[model samples]
Target: MDKCGSAMEFLENKNILITGATGFLAKSIFGGENLEGSTKCQETLFTVKSSKRDDSFGTQLIEKCIILIVKVIGKDLFQVLKKMWGGDFDTLISEKVCLVPGEVSLSEMGLKDSNLVAEMKNQVELIVNLAATTKFDERYDVAVGTNTLGVKHVISFAKQCPNLKLLVHISTGERGGLILETPYKLGESLNDIQGLDIATEQRVAEEKFKQLEESGASKEAITSAMKGLGLERAKMYGWPNVYVFTKAMGEMVINDVKNNLPVIIIRPTIVTRPSTVILLDMLQVTVGYATGKLTCFLAGITAIIDLVPADMVVNTIIMAMVAYELKPSNKTIYHVGSSARNSMRYIDFQRFNYQYFTKKPWINKDGDAVKVEKVTVFNNMTSFQKYMNIRYLVFLKGLEFANKVFCHSFQDKYNDMKKKINFVMRLIQLYRPYLFFNTIFDDTNAERLRMDIQKKDRETETFLLDPKEINWEDYFMNIHFPGLVKYVFK
Candidate 1:
């Protein structure tokens, strides 16, 4: 379908409701022109404002943006925005941005303000659902509540908005091997498991909760049990972990319940933000190695690791939103990742990490340069497990007996070592699917959307959603690694 108007023209006087304002992606959306030194984003905003659309359009953006954030992260949510605008931030917020405290997991999005809800229903033209629990091993009940039921609630809310044009749901591309830009059919799963019902899954989680409660399980025990249950359920249905499984179910909910409302699902893979948490597993491990804590790595060294800049993903979302507004669709899926167009291998990433750290070694608290080494890589799980057994597991087993003879003096040390090992093993299990991932995110639909934007003159040129343009080596060496040190590690 061909959309008629430009993004600027379509967005004119629009009221947008964005859920999960506390999230990194949502914040980036709010930042708009003030992202990651993106002068292009700034230029685009000024260009749009300067355009001769109308008297009001030239003075301010079309969006009267509303955001929903939980109290936990809402305390400092606007600090960055405030920094960007300084004294004028409050005035700008008063005029354009509206902050609402709520939880998407609850019915009506936990939005209790009746008058404000009424206002949103009357004026909201677009809805972007960015609320999600990204923990790979999150509790089953919690994941479903936010990821699955959350979408249902958002849709229910959208149905109330008389002027709603489109709803954009931010999802992840975690399904392995040639992931496509296609909608998930209700009850259909990656592993082809039958009877994969959302209602059944919800029931299962609730029943498990009841069982734990009846057994007088402690809060910590319940949390651990629920986390294991999520992974268990996910693996049973052919997914790797809790986050992706629940998110996939979220998409299913959209397909099942969206009764003719325009919808777009954007699946981004391993999105990296400058000062925010980088979603890639390798980067976390690399951090350990950089600090001289990790000596070996487990991964399919040759496997392709999909990576995309967060700003690029945001740009794609914006383009998709405008496209949907111009040409409404019942459902459309876009895989906004680099795998299909520009792929990076784990081996190359490893080399880059080594090169970067070796050249500029980390300094310890003692003011000495920590030495570096090329970590031994294991291509298979068996080898990795074997290595772990030989290297540390055997010693821990012996330490179990030694603790009894030493008046339990070594008990604390043994416990710490065992706990660290368990944690590492758990992390490895959860991340193995990605570390050895063999997938290509097909972005044909995304490319078409880019082409559509391209045809409408270069005004939309600043939205650089194309992954093929990125130089991976240059980006990691000069941009990603240094940013990690400054913003995250430091």
Candidate 2:
């Protein structure tokens, strides 16, 4: 079949319901530059719930416009508007998209209006469950409620949808170590934990929380315990973090309950923007005058960063959705990542970061250029610790001594500086695993889908899914980094 014909056949007249529509991944899928003005689907329903209690009409309108601009026109355009005139542009996307107030964590997606829920069930053709807590150190109760039991609720809702043809579950490629484009069964022990069933698990988790509360446990103690439980449970299940562990369980639930329904599991690894949260935090620390102009410290960190641009991930998702819809599959798992196709090590990413900052040094409030020096790279933790002692700890001690000897009143300031440095170190320790991650996701299925697209379709379809086509250095330098600086860093 021709590309246009294939796309039309798959997406024409389809009503897609996306959970977590406000999230990074879903926004990329529906509002990516490639899909802009080329969305073949008839209508998209984004499920959302306002955290604000007194949300006014003006607030809603602004929220809607922001969604349209980011998910539709892309952030680059939004950044352009802010940069050009310090003004905003309105969107015409409301005509094609509908925002339905709902919460995925609740039953029936927390939709209070039964009629609206029924209407959605009757008309929705595709259901994409992208709602989940992505924080690695998320609390156990929250993670299980949203990521584990939430999948069950979505599956139940999908089963009720009379017109449902496809149900896509967005999972993490980092769940199983060295992910392969194949079915993975949780270990027997992990399976046993899952066998407790969603309801039972939810009850158990809640009861644990309640028991801790009744025991008069401190909030910090309870939080630490919950976090530890999540980590221990994840380790027992052979997963790395709570985020991936719960996501894996969510997939398991779908696999067990899908029952002949067409389902596609898209596992994407480290789906990042031009600048990731870590990079942003690092920049905030190292680019300031207080950090002694350490621009090259990030470059010294040696690790493999298996990252795929958010745009690339979204393109793959849209194409996969269309391809799977055109040819129904009982269950298909696609690894949409760059590790197996075009991998960029941490060192390379650091080099690009250093190069970018070196060319455009951050100007401090004092109107002085803060330049970065070449950093010392340490491979082992021992060496890193030794370097930290010599570079920062010793310097801090000297400062403390000077304050004590000369300016005794500056003790508070010296203590504050020490705390800030320690906090930064803690942040680095928290992100140590991801900074040094080495897992490679096998994207065989995703690649085959890219190749399967008809030449005619390839020409007409704006969204390209091939990871091999991506140029990492160019994308980071030109597209990603600039967007990050303008939109996020600004």
Candidate 3:
């Protein structure tokens, strides 16, 4: 039997639970949108049978596996599933997929219904925890609640499942230098801070909240203070931002509690969608350049910007899940991206953007092509600040002087331009660490997994997770850029 055959056999009739099904990456998992938002739907269970057989590897896997979505609260996600199944939607919902709504930050994922929770505990063999708050400067309480405590809740729930074979946790790799595929040991800190404890962090957040409440701080003030505290704590512990710090803590939580449970962490770098704010600043920059709003960029032209498509990451996750289940190895980390293999440098990215948009320019509301030019690149903060002052700030100062003398005729334009400048500067400050990052994620384990799969199957295209096969130029000029124009550009 081939590897694909073995995987299919292993997946047949298996019950799988996917948390955070309404998130950006999870939407790709179900191939749909959460039309009515992620919070509106409540606990509801569905027993669905495979709708139809397809040529794609994902659909093929779906045909064999029974997927239980635990966090899908609205019909929008299911509607996409319905569209994929067409007339068979009702039948598939009845026999193929299972829907159970719950929140991961809550204990036992907030599954208040005892009967449903017990049923899930008995039937669920595989669990994938993708629930996360990916903001870099998210409020301390919210970040700890979702990214850190949520992992604890999921692990606790997993411990109750007697038949659980594997728990795959979605993480990320965003630090600079040579990043290796390795598990984060319990209470480990990137800055080597001794005695890092998850419980202590939670206690600190609670105390801070109480302090703010006792002082009668306004909601806005509390929010601002919490955000600031998250950043401060993250920096104190040697992380660049709050998101990665909490995510690291999340891995710690899993290590602390997952005694004998089979767990694997998939740390993909900069997926096409910015789930972890790692690529969010880049995405915003791309949109600005494509629409002719951006004229300057701060980046090291020679630095590599690692990126993997969301579908590719999802494919890797599915394959990793099966590979780990079959082999049951102690190696828990896998970095899935195209940085060390087929790296895309900032220069090439800039060139691709210029080529794509210049040839096919964005049309404005006035029915004219928005001409785009190669943006002036500043490799360092000093140069970028000087350029900003000479180009935008000088104009703003002129506008400010003229506003007072000319009865504030240019007030709206001045304010708008000033706001844009301030926003861009803040973004640069928030993402300065990553802008010139020179990290190369070591993906030896990921490569070995791919090799093992292909060695048995021989036909590798069906499960294309290897990042070395991507042609950066073609992907950017054709697929990625066009998708941005159609979906993201205003």
Candidate 4:
């Protein structure tokens, strides 16, 4: 990703240190905006700085440009200049955004170079930490260490950073923890602090894992032991799965100890493609890739992929930070989700998938587009055979024969494919409780944050990347999305 003028402008004046710079939302919010407001329906906020379509003039969120424009273009040259300066579009944001080399696993954020982390800690005003093991089946050790313990370290470290005004922690909405209301207050501490007293939970897990490490257990045995621990520990957590359960713990830890730090928690819903910035499409997130999406590629079928653009998540994070400045003392939970303002259902997503992927695929596999026929869901996984089995078997058999003709065992290949498909389906169903299950998010706080952005009298700069201020359908269908088929597979 090459740097541009707008990227430079957005980073001006602000010394921000972020943990996860490579993730989708982290990249989108810090990167350039779509300028035309990107493709999200939720009422969120993000800062966007862009160079002109050509290189003639530069463009940014708004306020930054107002000052320079006043010098040359003069006040009220166009509209009520003072009132519009904060929301001006011809601004630069390059100075505010800065990427730091930081990771959560180590004591000092894996930064062995104390001088560097110290320098960053000293000069940085806002410390944004979003890095975590978001993988659903992630091991208890990995998640707890990076997500839970790591947060403790950040709070402790941020306490030392004299310039640190606010420490914005990014979280997931699915960390719904037995709460029934919108303005949910902080809850009980996630007792998994020491990893489930776990070794004690299942003597077998402890003995097995220890033996494996002590004797250098075989890879397969270690893998099986790890799996056993995950299953046992997950059942103990009481939530739907480990991903949310662990994140909830991380949040609790952050809330309990973060007393004096002007902090806020921003929890985003199922995050997806960029809501604004566009990179060369390097790769898709593993969680997104393994389940709903890969199913379509294997069968060329259409199914709704329900996700909020990464851009929206990042924008919401920045907005939450700005909101911190106005009400610096409040320690509240702000949800960056799509429960109310803008939500399209899974069935709607399924409909779109069926219509588009089948007819106008990006690759044209057979020199012409290949469309998929409609599919029906079953209450029984075993029933795929009696109904669609024969059809799928036919394709499998053909592929097997071709592989054998080329001197390979197509049977083994088909067997592996079948196994992987079945595994993905099981995990998909496990997560279905969140995706298929109907859960409403009340983002009244998110709405109030937007009000702050829209106010002409507000001193904070506007990014124009407001979610409620744009057309969702056009951006999602035309500019942002589609890469799921065109680029992810490519």
Q: Give the winner by lDDT.
A: 1
Clashes of each: 0, 3, 6, 24
lDDT of 1 by residue, 51-96 (tens): 2223352123332121132322242434666576778765555556
Q: State the lDDT at 214 in candidate 1.
A: 100
**Which candidate tops TM-score?**
1
Which lDDT tens digits does candidate 3 get at residues 8-67?
Answer: 454566777877765666755544222112221222133222223335534533443333
**Cα lDDT listed for each candidate:** 0.76, 0.68, 0.74, 0.53
> Alpha-carbon error at 356 in model 2, in Å?
2.2
lDDT of 4 by residue, 1-490 (tens): 0221232233345566666554445545433343233212111112122222333222232432453333323422223222344554234222233323344655666554456567766877777777777877766556666677678777887898897778888876553333322322244323433344322433544565687789888877777567656545655655566667567667767767887777788877766556443322332322133223433312212222334566666666766665566555353677766655566654554454455545455444455544354445443345544544575666766887888788775767777877775776666556656544455566777777767654622323344334454455554455444544544554
What lDDT tens digits, residue by residue, belong to model 2 across residues 113-227? 6777888999999988888898887888889978987887899899999899788888885532576776545332333444534455567668888989999999999998887
Error of 2 at 426 (Å): 4.5
Q: Candidate 2 — what's its lDDT?
A: 0.68
Question: What shift in Å separates residue 334 of candidate 4 from its native position after superposition?
Answer: 0.9
Pull out the clashing pairs in model 3: 41-73, 48-95, 48-96, 48-97, 49-95, 49-96
Report the poorest 10 consecutive residues by lDDT, candidate 2: 274-283
Candidate scoring better on TM-score of 1 and 2 = 1
TM-score pick, better of 1 and 4? 1
Q: Give the TM-score (vs. native) of candidate 3.
A: 0.84
